[model samples]
Target: MEKGTKFRIIKGIGLAALVAALVQTGRPSLAQQQPADSTETKQDVIRVETNEVMIDVVARDKKGRPVRDLRPGEIEVYEDGVKQNVTAFQLIEADSAVASSSEAKSESTVAGGTVREAPRPLNSLRQIKLVTLVFDTLGVESRRLAQQGALDFIKTQLPPNTYVAVFKVGNRLHVLQQFTNDRKFLEKAVERATTASHPQSEDLSDKIRKSLEELRQMGAAVGAAGSFAPPGTPGLVSSGAIKSGPPIMSGDGSVAMEKPDPVRLKLIEVTLNALRFTEDTQRASQGMSSMFSLLSLIRAQGDLAGRKTVIYFAEGIQVPPSLNELFRTTISEANRAGVSVYGVDARGLDSARTMRSSRDMLVAAVNASKSQLEKGSDVALSREEVMSTDTAESSLRKNEQGALEDLSISTGGFLTANTNDLRKGMGRIGSDLGSYYALSYTPQAQTYDGRFRQLTVKLSRPGINVQTRTGYFAVPPTAGAPLLPYEMPMLAAFNRHAPGKDFEYHVAALRFGASTNGVRHQLLMEVPLKNFTFTPDAPKKIYRAQFSLMALVKDKDGRAVQRLSENFPLEGPLEKLETSKNRNVFFTRSVTLPPGRYTLETIAFDRATGKGSVRRQELVVAPVN
Candidate 1:
């Protein structure tokens, strides 16, 4: 009810099938409008801020039924282990399919020194359920199962207050529908999402199979070749290709070695190159594009009110090591926005193909070992040893699913994997979305130190369970949310009455073709390397520079529409340090905005020296032709 209030809701109900049907509510309209595809009349942007933090507590008894009658005195809130005073309390309940406005029960209790009744009606509290169904690229079989699972969930008839949106994640995040309770619109969106699988996505499995075959071929070539010489000598060659006798002594007492076959050497080189190509292909198959699309969705959801839930349906979310930072950022943003991601592995009842593949590879290895043994090669491997090895498929599957688990569980949600009955999983998720106890408190630590503040909710009663987010960063709230560390500087610069040109930098806002979503523009910031301070690590013989670049795009009315931020960690050999100072660092980011004129404020801060530069530029986005 207040500006800048931070709300934390406990994790939603248990697993169930996803993308269900919903009915309209008697509460205030929480349905969100879809983004305009074409340029039209301008609409002013409004933002609200709050200083209070709200936590949604779900207390259940031994029987797993919600404990609805708990009083504020019976509950204790702790932030960073310090007990906090409860400022406001309310119970938000999910309306039944046939329930009317009058039948819904909304209770409120605000306490300072004494508890008092709420002055506003239940609908004014804006206690509504918001869910977004994101369908990632899937294989043919997975698409079928996912579609059916979503359709079944929809037919179950969700709560009247539950509003749903549909999106498809591929090369980009495509919104099929905005927030709505209408079953027809949601159904149509799901249809399009299910049928709109990326063309290349279906070929992903084929590509992996081909890559594996290439790896097998390379492995065979390596096995066929005898012992390898050290570097600088001839590489792998056919067994016995070299002389089996001792080295011949020359007249000068030098040992002359037999030359290796040129054709064999060429084959080895080709195989090695193929091995490298296969490795790169597998890493690319880990779905970096999908991860970025998902990030875009979470960041955009930060602007919405209350806690949001994302039902992410994908065959599997494989996050490679290189994308670790991006994955963490995705989770961090979701936690900040109070979004719980429930990942549903669409590969229902995964076939035993993985196990079969492992078996086949092992068999080939055993045959090759037998051939080597027959040839009296000491390098031959034992069949028993190869058979004793664990199946790599099991470990690989666990690793592939680890990303999904971490992404979901870190944000107060769970992953449903290796299950054929997606309907059951969605049913649990649906129940979790039902309702919870809303508690508000003002944190005692007023300093926005950008550090994580641990949160724990304790109940005085026994045999009761409470579920909520683990913690939140101690950042001051703005626009109903907190500005991230990298974002804080950009906003500060935008709000300054006078620009501080601490250093020299060039910025360009280049406009591109217009699309349905908005006009595409590239924001580029260039700064001389000499503008930043570099610290030299004598032992490592490298120079390091730390800094960040950020920008804020504000409309004509002075309301911020978009904020971009990025950090640069520069390091180079000491020999190149001087040369680097003569070069410039360029940063670029693409953003889409409605066709209109706006002011772009940019900042470049050197973290090492704590020095920064601020600049302003005017940009215009022409409407679509």
Candidate 2:
């Protein structure tokens, strides 16, 4: 129990009662109050469809090295060019199943005769859904020694069922932490963001002298209270007194000058037009709306489509170049929602003397305030605006490494740099998320013309290198309706890792025990109902089934806390001559949970040949002691 002390006693007694039981049973208001013919008989029995394929494979090794092993029949898949047939094969194996379940319970109690009790072990490894951690602290000026090495590299390389979240842009974008897995509340939110510094030039000269004393007390309370006026204030006070009549003061004249209160000068001209929304423009618009609200809350928490992984961590910069089409439509909707984006440069773990003493204290405070405004003195910026703000901060550090290499090549994702060798870039992102491999197919262009299709994954034998996700978007057949096989396996379990599209109906498994109405929790599913097959002789047969289940209760650094979802019914029995012998079926549900670790997901469908399947599992619940 030392994976950081069972992730801090299961994240301090089950993450707030499993996030209040996953906001009371996994949302959609308890699957929209059941009936509607039980949600159209679970969307006329499942009909899942998902796509997100970007496996660039080239793991060389004729002596090339990157050949970590290569399986799934030595890999080979394609799409827009055709070739298919690799049904399903997941690799992702970074070892540590809690140190291989404590070395198989210490080699089974020293090979004794009574220490039995195995069961509880099935989260099938591969877990890393977007654990982003970018705390460059905008060139760290010691903010507690760069927040003690970014909270000791997020409490020593976070992992346990991982879900971590943190954002720090410096000069603005702060969320210090959010998608927690609670490494001591993300190490006290990186020690309360090491008292953030480095907005430099003396923190933008104390934010432009607190924006000119809050714009001169908001233009003297909008010139003595004219209720926030300003829609052509007499055409800006008749073009400033038709060029000069409002201020005639001479050598100690008793009436020196007073006409300036058009409602406290329009509340100091709208508080200096609301300090043009500063704080580094609200931390680059709250770090791009907290990275698209943590990718739309991990795609509305439906176990992020196919095999997901986000990892981000930044230092690279693309903040508002109109958010590059919202970061290429959020990495093309996280590659059609199968998510995958690994970047981690954190300014390549800085420290070239903390980036040359924070660029030599911002070029010696902009060359001593441009040599005191080129000698005229009272410097409020000029000397050609401090040499054009040091040439736009040297072109924003050379366009932040080409905007983190175009957001890690438009999201197929992979860019680990520096951070004192971020553990060899998180061990090459945990060996490319554990020897990556998951190929799917089935896109004979079947309508859904939403556009972008292109994909290619091939490897009949050359040096492997496929990294995945290049194109998707097809989606349209009137946006494929007629759902009910449990809403077509929860909408093809939200696109079971799309690409070519057949990755063994996206598998997800989990189970837990201790019944007697206490800590039960069972969520077993074996999707893969593909087009509802069965034909011995058929005459008037009509079978379409689908299913979807969700269960949550996370701790151990995975967050969530608790949730549950249901929508099953893949009915059977329709024969005129023969073909209804209950072709494998099973759906069960029970939840009592109180103790710990829980994450159960199931999505299945077979809407008369549309295809759908997904299964995920993880249950622990043991603790009533």
Candidate 3:
């Protein structure tokens, strides 16, 4: 079959399967219901979902220099004015995890290979969480210049192997890039954020005017040229009148050879396309509306529950008016996903000097135009009318500033004023990100009653102000358990490998599986040699493969109970098949009860080349009645 036909068949089948899955999930065709408390159980049991918390502490003196010597006990935590115990504490160091050079290559081989080396357990005992950088660039006049400093800061300051995602927020939020350690890719994405006409900006009018002017110039030049006679004529135009014929003349002695200039037409087309792009971007920038993008990114990163930092960049945030409720919902979602947002005020570095100067010039031009119009009309402006107009203009400027301040405060990020030393401000931001501390604690209550809980983190040492998320949304009790049972199968499908003629195929799929019975899940994954076929006559082939699988299970008190390792082999031909499976069960099994959350992780490694892949999942099991 042709590739086109094959693709169509595959696409149709995929669409049908997706529709069936949606129906099976009992979700509406047009809209799916939000995850709610299960009504099947009669007992009103609230399950609290445990989330990894990563705090970014900014310690500065009267003059802004980072103070990094603070200890764990010097910090205090409060939830809505109620003090909570700090269950975990740690000081993150540079050598937290050892890096392997050939890890990627080892994991890609078909032969079962040991991919990931075991992570050396840290002495410090702080709960780790995923951090995302939300970068907002809406208010910035030059995105390219501003993004450079921001990208440099992140690349140089963030810890190695940190799960980071980058987003640009303006009139709309755009996920410019997803979580990855590839420094080059991140830099390229940042540099690509050039200043374009945005939906909310007044500069669009100038763009439109330029487009119109170009179009007019083309029209005039085409008109000045007489009807085309020879092919090599300077102003000769293509006559689109005929389907397939030479230039045709009209009855009025005019040749039907007049056509719009291709260059101008192309320009107009590009301008129109840009306008549409701006509109789509505007819609995406709405706060919380772009959560799905973040969710998808998290899914791609496997389990985000065990990450050190998340950096957020954005220009402005327009959260819902019911901010308190919205905050709870957003926080709850982030907690369940094991992620926290560290908003990098992308707009903060932009100096207002250029924009202020431009505005002043524009104002002067407008006033001069008004004065000329009045003089030419031989009419005098009324004093009251003139005063009213001035008042209105002043109000508009004030409103713009107020809007910027509101956005900065609502998202737990600071607003940087337009200053001469823009790069200096960015450098300070980088230092703050690099030197911050992280803190995590479990709440006394396990129930999320849809109530707003205020969070306060204070340093025992005076003269230090800790900036963190104001609070998080409380999770409903019943919604804490794993809802889908096919998570493993789905993961396997995603990582399945197909073998060709000369090379053997090896695939390792990993996911943190939740267990309520304390009877730990012993996943025995096997890849039969017979399932893969290869040419025997192709040079003497030695397909040696090794891979490792690591699983870590932690209980409510943030203590690791079960840490397991398994190695597997991949080799042999179709007939003489070699199969490998690794399984380990936890002996000290205790069923999860109310008031605790558990984290599970699985890492697949190739022993041959020392490459590996990782997956993480969280499970919250409530107590049995």
What's each prediction's TM-score?
Answer: 0.55, 0.25, 0.39
Total clashing pairs for each candidate: 25, 82, 45
Judging by lDDT against the true structure, name the best candidate.
Answer: 1
lDDT of each: 0.55, 0.40, 0.38
> Residue by residue across 51-72, what tens digits does model 2's lDDT show?
3233323254464345555555
Q: How accurate is candidate 2 locally (lDDT)?
A: 0.40
What would the C-alpha RMSD of candidate 1 be, to one decimal place?
Answer: 27.0
Model 3 error, position 589 (Å): 47
Count of clashing pairs, candidate 1: 25
Candidate 2 Cα RMSD after full superposition onto the native fold (Å): 28.6
